[model samples]
Target: MKDDTKIVHVGRANAKRHNVVNTPVYRASTIVFEDTQQMREAMDGAVGDRKKVMFYGRKGSPTSWTLEEAMTELEEGFDTVLAPSGLGAITTALMAFLRTGDHLLMVDSVYEPTRHFCNGMLAKFGIKTTYYDPNIGEGILKLITPTTRVVFVESPGSHSFEIQDIPAIADAVHSFSDQNIVIIADNTWGTPIFHKPLKLGADISINACTKYIVGHSDVMLGSITAAKEHFPVLYDGRQQLGVAVSPDDAYLATRGLRTLGVRLNQHQENTMKVATWFSERPEVEKVMYPALPSDPNHRLWKRDFSGATGLFGIVFKQTSREAVSAMLNSVSCFSLGYSWGGYESLICPSVVSHIRTASTWRYAEPGIRLHIGLEDPEDLIADLEIALKSFNTFL
Candidate 1:
């Protein structure tokens, strides 16, 4: 499909007689089969390897397929699966690839929530997680074990903002064995436009659609997109786990994704401006954004990243957590909270220690993550200036 055509109809269909542009949402738990043979066919395989099916609402309704089709087009070589939440997608993708005795290599700078799940749940299942430095690249090969079944990467490591050498890492991980270790990337930050993880060699690209994809922050959804080789398992795992999302949610997501290109552009522009603004501040000792000129991974970022979003961190030297809070609360425009990629700006004190066991988090002070929104940069900067004043006041 052509790019524009793909955007409009890649995952959508005008299947009914009315010929509506968007897929009609069909909500159902019981699908009546006309005959015994029809019932057997419905049970055989809802969606076939060759074509789509109206097999079961659980496999996905037309509404769900519309979104999946669009997402698949955006992510080159990826077959997609939907999850109830971002973590649901994350956990489901992992479950599809890992057996009990399998080992997994993870990035140390993964989202704390993901890290928490890894520590608490994956470990209990007898799956060992070895966290490598985000910058390790092909050097990761030395750390891989025969039992390693998956390599999970969250590039520009969530709050830490460390850009990874994905192509290099992919080449190394794939050489481990024919055991076919899956390369899973949490591509939520980049979506598919800015960075095509699958095209770069990842086996799977997962997203917390709750962030940018949904745009409104009103919906909670996640997606796990798979390379052709692994699409079957992703879909199978989602099917068995009963990961069907509501049609209403799917409709909202579809609408939100239509504006993703424009929204992401604004987000990138605002984030660069905000990161630079924070970097020059005396109170901020370090800015943990890959786009920063002085960042350790700046070259890698420039080479691989088409853009960025509002999820960068700023560390204040010699400032207490209370001081950071005071400033964050003082800001008129930057509301203190979690979750990002919404139209409204948000600020939060970011804590990244769960996976910091290998390296000491020896910053002079704790850091705060900010999500710059569509607000005027000047107004946002002015609000931040006042917030800094409050920080100084607390000092």
Candidate 2:
């Protein structure tokens, strides 16, 4: 089925609840069994066949299960596990395959919180993390050690927007027969609509449902979809951690997901328009959107992705803090805030050089990340025009 059709139909099969079109919220806590034998069977099913049974409320109910089914199908994975937040998904997926003394190859442009988890928490657990260039591609094989267990990738990396050669990296990892190395890709930016990491040889795919899946900035949820060989360990890890997402949030995310394809199309169109305008501005040194033909990572993005999303970054040629602040303060349409994928536009300054351990952020100029929402491109451009004028005032 096409993505749009899958989004609308995948989870609605069991909507037989009162003949409803959507899966009704099944807020559950303590499920009771008629007898000890039934309870024993449920317990067995929870461990032996997780998808077919729900032994406890924490395990999941029809509502959350529906969302999981939809996500698993959309991601084209064996199964999926839900998390309370994006960071929860990342940390849990990492801990699933990593053991004490295990080494992790992390993309240098990974989300900052993921880096912190590796450096701060994982470090304390005796695991070592080595940051690798986002562009390493097949060269990633050279960094593999006997202790290496996982490679974490985030395409169009956080803030700087560098697209990794995912297929090349995956091939390199799989070529090494010494140890079974797992590959995890953060699919929040590429999203299920555009990129399916598992199809590209990634072992697991993660999505911060808070962003595009939730569509609105209302709910906080995450999903980890794993290939058949890796689902057991990933599921066991999440269960051991006792991670669970609210059924209400899961329902909301599912609702938001149904419209994801259409919403993302609008986001891509609007973002491309705004990003093109930024490229023509004199104050702009670069527009870090892979969709742009002029971007350094465009070839990789075009090769691997079917579409782009609302999020992208721009660098000012030479601007001060005060100048950037002035521009931010002057923007009427774009909200100066963090987080993206909502219907409303947002802008925030990013300083990534300090966070890099293996990468050199060549651009010393101030960078502004923009989430071009569903707003009309002309209005957003008009707002940016005013902001840029204010930026020039301080310069």
Candidate 3:
């Protein structure tokens, strides 16, 4: 089925309660069984079929399962597990395969918090991480050591916006490794609607459902979808970590998911209009969006992705911090804050040069990340024009 059709129908078949179109929230903690035999069967089912049978509240309820089912269908994976937030999903997936003394190959452009987990928690656990260039492609084989258990890739890396060649990296890891080495891709930016990591050879695919999947800023949730061979371990690890999402959040995420296709379409349309406008501005050094034909990574993005999201970065020309602040502060429509993939537009300064270790950030000028949102493109442009005028005045 097409993504739009699947989005509306995937999890709704058995989700309805009393003929309701949407799944009712099942607030559960302790599930009561009819008898001791039933309880024994439930325990066995929990161990054997975690998705279908819920022995306890932490294991998951129908509400959460509906979302999981929908995500699994969207991601084209064997199954999926839920987490409290995007970072929780990443850490849970990492801990599932990693152990003490293991080496991790992390993309230099990974999300900042993921890098922190590698340097702080994973390092504390005695695991070694080697950050590699995002554009390394098949050359990633050089970084794989005998101890390397996982290679993490985030295409269009956080803030930097470099699209990693996922297929090349995954092929390299599988070809070079004698032992089982998993390739995990963060699909938050290139959501299942745009790109399917599993189809591109990744062993595991992760999505910050808190973003596009939720389609709003109201709920925080994440999903980890695994290949068949890796599902058992991923599921066991999530269960061991006691990682559980609130059913309320799950329900809202699912509700938001229904409009994901339409919402993202509008987001892409609005973003293109805004990004093109920025490209024409003298104060803008570059509009870092892969969807643009002029972008360095556009060829790869075009090859692998069906569409682009609302998020993109804008690099400013040589400018003062005060001028940038003036622009950010003067914006009436775009909120100066963190987080993206909401109905409302947002803008935030992104400085990644200091945080990177594997590759150098050559641009001396700072950049602003923008989430174009669902607002009318003309209104958003008018707002940005005013902000840019404010920026020029300060300059």
- Candidate 3 deviant stretches above 4 angstroms: 48-51
lDDT of 2 by residue, 1-395 (tens): 89888999987876888999888888878888999999998888888547657678899988898999999999999999999999999999999999999999999999999999999999999999999999999999899998999999999886999999999999999988669999999999989999999999899999999999998999999999999999999999999999998989999999999999999999999999999999999988889999999999899999899999999998888978889899999998999888998888999988889889998998855778999999899999999999999989999
For model 3, what is the alpha-carbon lDDT of residue 380? 93
TM-score quality measure for candidate 1: 0.95
Backbone clashes under 3 angstroms, per model = 3, 0, 0
**lDDT scores in order:** 0.82, 0.92, 0.91
TM-score of each model, paired residue for residue: 0.95, 0.99, 0.98
Model 1, C-alpha of 96: deviation from truth (Å): 0.9
Q: Which prediction has more favorable lDDT, 1 or 2?
A: 2
Q: List the residue pairs that clash in candidate 3.
A: none
lDDT of 3 at 344: 90
Candidate 1, lDDT over the whole model = 0.82
lDDT tens readout by residue for model 1, 198-237: 9888999988888888898899988888888899887877
Q: How close is candidate 2 to the true structure, as a TM-score?
A: 0.99
